[model samples]
Target: MSVQPTSAPTWHRLSPRMLAIHPIIELGRALPALVGVFFAGHAGGHGLLTSLAVAVAVVAVSITRWFTTRLRITDEQVQLRHGLLRRRTVATRRDRIRTVDVTAHLLHRVLGLSRVVVGTGTSDRKNESRIVLDGLTAVGAESLRRELLHRTPVAMTNQGSEPADELARLERSWIALAPFTLSGVVTGLLVWGFAWRVEGESGVDLLHSGPLRAVGHGLDAAPTALAVVVVGAAILVFVTVTSVIGYVLAFWNFRLVRHDGGAVQVTRGLLTTRATTIERRRLVGIELSRPLLLRAVGGARTLSIATGLRVGRGAEKGGEVLLPPAPVDRARAAAARVLNGATALTVDLVSHGLRARRRRYVRALSGGAVLVTAAGVGWQTGGSLWPVPVAVVLLATSVPLAADRAAALGHAHVDGALVTRSGSLIRRRVVLADHAVIGWTLHASLFQRRAGLSTLTATTAAGRQGYRVLDVETPVAIALADAVTPELLSQFRRRPAPAPRATMR
Candidate 1:
């Protein structure tokens, strides 16, 4: 909804990035508008001067429309104003702001710009977005963030260099790669090889259906085996190239910026890059994942808290990613910062049966597959020692060790929070507001009920980190929730108590 200014309309700077995005506003519609103007001018064909005037009028209007649009960034609030005929100004204050994000495209790089989005509201923080500044340089965006944070008071910390009420920082970790792309390549190559092998088999020609009917019959339908081979090779090459590019783009230049206060900011991207903020208090949990191939490379998976956060409505998407791809130690340390727990101690939470089945066997299987494939390739090409298979085998050997390390990454009693680790391969460290939970829930599947495994879910006032918990005894999960609900509410009280300087051992 467009906000009505209370006192006065204050003008704000137009970040270069935001101005560049001005063109996007007229996207798709610009062509039609131009077409309409051309026809109207012809319809009103009169003296040469009148025709020239009409042309000039259209050009002037378009430029004015682009230039007149403005965004107002004030200490108290942010406002967006645009449109020649119908304009809107949406404003939200700082206290209500829950999430802030920076995103840039390749175009942004050339233009030296990025977009800032802030979101408000906890329950549905994802939807309440404001582009406080669509395009701003790195420095301007930071200054604007400080301005908004200063004018808008958050309960987490006051705008000062005072000792924090609770000292915490967010760290970043990433989920390992997805296996589909690689598997897809393997599938394509296998199919092509099969097609090549069977292109002239005795029964293969007999079973020809679509190709035979579409063209003619027999050899008439088939434009030589060479054409078939070339086409298949082209398609496979295209698919493989696109897949590789997508992977590189997805994880290009990933970085983590740790904050002194319990927060961390991460930025990564290839074409359209993204910047995310991980606030310690907003994180409810963490998740880890590893594909079969990634297991061979000793990589891990991670995903966490994007729940309950009513990012109090400001601009853009507010929640930080609970997922990323990172190594085990880094993931643990990141989680430590978020939980305000010790990085020194680690714990083991993996069930013995599941650990072997999920973590160990998979690693072995992936290693064996790569070794077999590499050996076959080595034989075909007359290899000198097949170094590829050796690497694969050794890398696979590290999977269990990484899982053991991440599992050892402990979650324990901190002064004001609960921290936990999940993932055998990709480790995710999660932090929860020990005293900020407003509701608690227990979830159990039929299998869980049978095995006495259930999960606990907790919700907080902020929109993010308001969702599910993992495996626990059903009854225990329920009791844990019930016991903690009242205790949490009471402990946080009207406001959070001062944060301890260091967690106790």
Candidate 2:
């Protein structure tokens, strides 16, 4: 809704243009049901009328959103009253507002309208602390975004002294890294799900169809290695193409800006554009991560460790992403710029030493040994030599994996931040501010104790809650805890016993 400042707060309705956009959105959501009705009606030769009736009913329900929804912004709170059958009144104190997001889907953009989502920084999974108002004019949305986010914190930290507003923008060359991202896998799963739904609704076994059966027969007739190679190559090509397309569609004109009012803004997306503003005071740290595939190509991605945003399974949730899969150096530079320095990300991390390296090998080899033993048992019973060779190959592969895992393990404290890096499959280098550490935990398993190693975890309310420095020397772990939170750890620390008096000797 387009809210204007008045002498006193008053309820406002959503833009009239929403009447056009909501029905289309609702029809899209009802597509599965509509398709089911169409198939059933077609069998009875009444498809057209039945489908039309369902679509009309969905439109009618969608149109009611405009009539029933009302929003109001007062001096102390923002209120949204929505729903028809079951009324809901959501309110949030103005002081608790941590973020202001303005978004416009394809339909809304065509009508020059946007959606405003005000977040209160609550960690509730249900998102009950969020207030959403859709169907505001483009200008009105920008005005509201400024109005909500202009109130600077009482104690502002220095984000940067740079006078320029723009921080970074999408580069065309960076699109090459898109193919290395997992977007293709997500797209493949979504497509598979839709096809599965269609098969169930149509009562057809797609895998047993004539074309698929012929392809399966061909694959079976070919040599196993050749068939595997051919299928893997095809899947790789398909995934790469889809990933590139998805990247472009989502981040065509991406831009990041540091506003003068102590906030940073990210604006991106092609079909559904979004503008997200996060106050600088809420940003606790930044995370730089690289999936195995992307790391192999020297690419990385980054996310802002902010209080209001939740880090979900996806790469970019609530606009937490600072950069998408790009060159590792570029990612680091962007992260450094955002944090107003390059010290933490560039500092040398302390190695966990040979014991940690040996532990990684032991863990990796143990896992591989289990597979080898299982394969041996299967060979003894089924008299199949194929399993033995596969297991042997996996066991051999674990050697390099163990080495990589060892290489990825490191941690350091630099520039008022705790920097830690770990994992080989998806290596993450997190630079968490020292002030953000609320507590410390030290743990060691029997094997770790024997090796004089402990895992030190820094507990914080931001990001993932706890960041671990794995398999370091026990003494070093305790020292790190004391460094981060001296008072908190002093009480729990184990003090050394005094030496026996020399007089006794």
Compare the candidates by lDDT and give the number of the best one: 2
RMSD of each: 15.0, 4.8
Stretches off by above 4 angstroms in model 1 are: 1-8, 12-68, 82-87, 123-126, 149-240, 260-263, 270-273, 278-285, 291-297, 303-319, 337-346, 350-431, 443-455, 461-466, 482-505
Q: Ten residues in a row with the worst lDDT in model 1?
A: 166-175
| Residues 6-90 of candidate 1: C-alpha lDDT, one tens digit per residue | 3456664455344444455444234344444444455466434553565455556655544566766444666777667777667
The local lDDT score (0 to 100) that residue 192 gets in candidate 1 is: 71
**Total backbone clashes of candidate 2, pairs 3 or more residues apart or in separate chains:** 0
Write candidate 2's Cα lDDT for 48-152 as tens digits. Answer: 789999999999999999999988877678888999999999988888888888889888888999988887764323567788889888877777677677753
Note the Cα lDDT for every prediction shown. 0.51, 0.83
| TM-score of structure candidate 2 | 0.90
lDDT of 1 at 303: 46
